[model samples]
Target: MLSFNSVSSRVLQTLNSTFNFTATRHACKITSIHAITSMKTQPNQVNHSVELGNRRKCLLDRPGLFGIKRGMITWFNDNGRQFPATVIEIDSVEVIKHKTEQEFGYTSVMVGAVDKLKNVNNLKLFEQAGVSPKHKLGEFRVRSETGLVPVGAELKADMFAVGQMVDIKGITKGKGFAGVMKRHGFKGLAATHGVSKAHRKQGATGGNQDPGRVLPGKKMAGRMGGRSSTEMNLEVLHADGDAGILVVKGCIPGPNKAYVKITDSVKLYGKSIESIERD
Candidate 1:
């Protein structure tokens, strides 16, 4: 009979040999499988879904909402019946100050327009604003509070780009007291037949018995024009960076040289350059 120690050593060697044989067979099987898969896969049919998904995610994660405020418009000339204008340049608009809910009980950005000359009565105001000598100064209220925009931070026409639509706010040209024929689009009396001073007069304001007085808010002609108006979706034609001018296509709300507030357009169709490009 074999000794106990010799028997144990023989058993261990046998186990090692069986393990090595099984491992070698498994390795050969794995290698063959890999070669078959490589041969089956076509180079031109490589999967790109992962890369495409990453790119889509990157675009969706873009930060911040970029848009302009309302009440701004661009101006241009009308050739025949067609209007043509472009937005060129807008001055550097800076946030001089802000109003917080805790202090002023509201959130607003105090945007200063052109500065004005100092007046003796408004000495303190001039000192507070620290604005240079200018002809006019106005404050524009923003919808929400923004980051701290330091004084002297000038805004440029590039804030807006070509093909953008803006809303313009201005006082309409005054027509004083106008007649019904001119103001309310009344047909007026017959030109030739029995017609006298009653030509432009409002025909019949009220009935005989039902209502004695003329109804309130009736479209009678008293005064026309000279009121605040907002024109929307004026296309930005060109932007002159150095000159700080924005040439827009078509007529704006106010007369030439009149002060107007230019803001982002409220109309859904008119907004950014991308939207215009699509149209």
Candidate 2:
């Protein structure tokens, strides 16, 4: 069995030669945010992804729930087998607003991604949030009574440690206008004799009308994907503070360079942020 050091060394070396990168274990730096980036940035954008695989399990205490973030993958375990990991880039998340119980009705912090937009409308919204012109914004509520991150404070990658379990939330790729078979996993009508145009259709909307018409939420499909998704308890493979990169142990939702909301695993440990090591 290979040790963690061996796995890290082999993977990084293979990655350096293939991508012409100067990355090491401690200094695994990536300039490009695209997953599976080329030595030079490519002209045509491709949705390259990182693949995850099974690893030896180790227990850990959950970290503080950080708010919404955006990230992309930079490496892969296989071409795409078993576990598909994501190398989430920490793009300088800064707090913009905070809602206290006294002020509003709940306690939560609103954070925005590093400002990259210059549009007037966007800047106006950013001003209200108390941050500079940011591209995207998201909010987070603490699970239990705890200290709040002051508005304008920046969120770092080191808030999470290697081996901790995290929950990643993001939008899945849009499939757009799908049938019931693909969207809701409904077994289609008979695909043989007598089946004309009802192959991939959801049969029987309403049989008898004791309650009348097609029920409100019947198993039929129009649109698919393009919605929020969450993958729980993805193990943190490697976490670097200086480089602001995180490699997790399983697949995350959405296309490359999609916005993601990462937090402490609610499924793993539903606790307060008491052991958060703030910088």
Question: Best-fitting candidate, measured by TM-score?
Answer: 2
Candidate 1, lDDT over the whole model? 0.55
> How close to the true structure is residue 198 of candidate 2, measured as C-alpha lDDT?
84
* Tens digits of per-residue lDDT for model 2, 170-272: 8999999999989999999998989998898888888586666787888788889999999999888877766777788767888777778887777666533
Task: List ranges where model 2 is wrong by over 4 Å.
Answer: 1-82, 120-131, 271-279
Give candidate 1's error at residue 183 in angstroms: 1.2
| TM-score of decoy 1 | 0.59
TM-score of each: 0.59, 0.64
175: Cα error in model 2, Å? 1.1
- For lDDT, the strongest prediction is 2
Give one digit per residue, the lDDT tens place, for model 1 in 1-279: 999978866765665576432234323222344344344554684345533332222121101111222233534434644454533224444445555545764444455444554553444454565754334345543333443345545556555567887767778889989989899898977666777768678788887888877889988889899999977787777665566676666666666556666655655322333333466
Give the per-residue Cα lDDT of candidate 2 at 225: 94
Error of 1 at 200 (Å): 2.3
